[model samples]
Target: MKTILIPVDFSDTNTNAIKYAADMGCDMPVKKIILLKSYYTSVYEQILPSPDFLLISADDIENERQKIEVQLKELMKKLKNRCHENIEIETVVSTEPIVRAIHNVVEDQHPDLMIVGGDMGHELSMIGEQIIEIAKSSPVKVLVIPPDCNYHKIEQALVPCDLEAVARLGVLKGLNTSHSWLNPKLMLLYVDPKKKHIGREAEFEASVKQLVNCYECKLHYSEDKNIVRGILNFATEQQVQLIIALPGKHSFFYNLTHSSITEALSLNARHPVLILK
Candidate 1:
């Protein structure tokens, strides 16, 4: 993990993500933390222009930049002091849309990860979906932190395995490769259908076991129809602090309701969800 680019709207809601990034930087090889603020003229501001609306000059833009810079600096200071060790802190204030701004940041910084604060209890709001869409498309990993959940030691985390992708792509193989995973004990949840099909269950389970054998892992199987809810239930029951998911490729799980399950779990996560791509 070299760089983490965090896009903030300068709202109090996202402060948690900012702090979370700082906490992560403490132990990881996180070299840089870029705090970005994307701003634009609002609809109300356009309709009710300032005193010199018609003759708006460069001064207005500079003033806005300075304001955002000040805010970013404050956040930068807070994060810098939070960590016991030193890491680079940068502040970027952009006038582009939030989503586009994020892409631009990623293009420029090439961050290893992106983190954002998410709301709880319902499906992703419009803005949340846009943040998630960026995650879905980004080659880098994206970690979505829930609003109410505080950052603590990640003791145990859950990983849902359909036993297909992990076999073909070795997605789970890279689980411990990243320093950010913190080597938490992993729980692999496999929810099989109540009605069995004549597939290679034994072979699949064997493959799954081989990948997880190096790390402490517990295997689980569920017969629930709603796989998304089933996974979330297990997460809550086990008191897991994290869930790791990879972006989709055409596989058995993807064909069997990919968007619905992945979107629901990532967007409406009760625990912090890390989307590894």
Candidate 2:
């Protein structure tokens, strides 16, 4: 991975993700890190008056943008201390919506990865609430760092998947070519909730092995009524440092039955979850 894009909202959750990215970049072949902040004015903010109950002037908006730029630059300086001197860091302040701003950056720069924070509390920041949407829509891979997750050497990663959609494993081939720094052992987990797909385990293993030949991968089968719980339990037992989520018909996001469960997994996972497109 050569470049990483991170959108900052100045929340405690976002601050943690920024630090995590800085630390992770040191280990990867990362060359540049882009810090983006969106200053888009919502309809309510434009219509509602300030504390003085009067519409803010254009100068006030420019002043706010300047202040945000200063903060972004300060963050870049701190990240530089955490990264190797060779790594280049840049900042971008935009007036477009957060999603649109990210899309423009991706189109122009084609970053290898995007990192975001996952909020675990009910009081979610606007950016935090949109994390899943961003991951789903982003053309590049996205690594989500939970509020309490700390950076650690990624020695092993768990991939909970449906073997029927073996085509999705094709993306894993890039792990060796594009992100050689992330050479962690892989564990492909199949949660057979109803035990209906019993005899096809070996067949699926053969298919998965064919696709992920570049890495050390092992296939595992689990039995549980709740797929989310099953995946979490196995991850805890194996002590994996990351969870690889594939998006497709049998994707991680699809398996998550409800918004609440999705939030629970994304926001509470002890290890970071990498959503691959």
Candidate 3:
């Protein structure tokens, strides 16, 4: 069975991600979902109470684990109810930080994908750094669920292509292997910010046609100044359900996160983004 590993926190992000996962499970090949909760605190050492008063004894640790296990069971029950399938849900309580725990699970469980809840237009901090690290480093594809976005079938996927991204065109064809995304129309979106064609028009069209041959696809050109906005606007206008992006030296992912005043799309996009690196 295919698995999706989700790191759980008590935030709205966790709930939204799980809901999205359950909805996707209805049509996709997702059968097993592993929910992970990492145990960590933000308090400083000096601020912590004395060991005698606050130390977690072995018994206390076990009790706490049991408590969280109950919570996880309840969470799993609720998530399963949200879907129509007989989904098998499991939970893990990690002793390390969330990111580290996720890496550990990836190495051990070999989950098919990991889902993240994206926050919009926020200041960079620990969470931002962790998200960037995971996206660039995860062995499997990483899907980001936008804020307030619900799970649904991907009817048409919006692909923002750069001249340099042709080599990674396999990302489009790979989508056809899945049940949920099988044969969804591929909208090859290219935001021609400048009116000048970079001379890769023919190559782009040919490559797209070859890769997504099993599915219907079209090449779209826009004169919007911003790359990210152009793709989102076009997706919204066309009611595209998924956005696939390739990350590399000259790709939109690199430009957005590497700029001095970064606009992190993985953290800010209003639609689910599949980062096919």
Candidate 4:
């Protein structure tokens, strides 16, 4: 809630995500936003035969760094203009690979959240392909913004949960701290492919009770052969603006393996998906 870290490739997908973060930063308790760009020489580029004169030099790398810095500055300026004057805007250019760059930034910034752009339909963009890895690996929570998704007030949020593993829901305990920024009515959904039910599990009910005390929340159940479809269908029907994915079997990476479900979410999702560790 205080700081957000966003890695950019300067693609349209990333641009939209930056804009979304800016809008949300203005509304939330964000104090700073860091834009990161990574630069690295690929193995192919390093090993391929080339004229000695044509080989990349220190000057070439310096020029490339300057160019990326300029781009980052431009984006930072745009965010500054869009967000509240009090919010700080910063940029980082790294000479490491994108994943490592992100890790380094996360270590250095300790951001409250990391936001990344994703396109799950057809072919995955480079950033899109890395979304799951980043979310799973990041110590901080991550928000995945679908391509072209604009900012909207999150009045309602749907959390597709695996009720059998209520312990994983502890990741959401932090939400209680951001109540004003989100202020969403929480819908905790348990989807059973075999049409099973939560039968008098005292511990499970206790966990749900604790969540109710944390936020204005309700527990719901659904029966569907396809879990991903069930979650998306419920989100759409309820008109929720955010979907929170907790770690473990019900995470995005688990569901993204199904191409059909991935495309379904890519095509139908209008809001961002928050991945909590």
Against the hidden reference, what TM-scores do the models get?
0.80, 0.93, 0.83, 0.88
Clashing pairs in 4: none
| Backbone steric clashes in candidate 3, count | 0
What is the RMSD of candidate 1?
4.4
lDDT per residue for candidate 1 within 1-277, as digits (tens), equals: 6788887765444787788878877767788888878776655665575787664446776887888888878888888899646589888877777777778888888888888876443543433546545666666777888766677777798877666566533665565676444578888777666635236667766776786665677767777787777778888899998887645753322334535744564545468888766
Model 4 agreement with the true structure over 79-109: per-residue lDDT tens digits:
8999989999989888888888888998888
**lDDT string, candidate 3, 117-200, tens digits:** 665544333333466667777777788877678877878888787655566667656656753444677888777778655676
User: Per-residue lDDT of 1-277 in model 2, one digit per residue for the tens?
Assistant: 8899999988888988989988887787889999999999876777789798988667878999999998998888888998878889988898999999999999988899999988777455667888767877889898888888889989999998888788888888887786676888999998887775688877887898899988899999898877777888898899999999887768766556559545555645597988888
Preferred candidate (TM-score higher): 2 or 3: 2
Q: Give the TM-score of candidate 4.
A: 0.88
Q: Which pairs of residues clash in candidate 2, taking residues 3 or more apart in a chain or in different chains?
A: none
For TM-score, the strongest prediction is 2
User: Candidates ranked by lDDT, best first?
Assistant: 2, 4, 3, 1
Better of 1 and 3 by TM-score: 3
- The deviation in Å at residue 97 for candidate 1 is 2.5
Ranking by TM-score: 2, 4, 3, 1
Please report the TM-score between candidate 2 and the true structure.
0.93
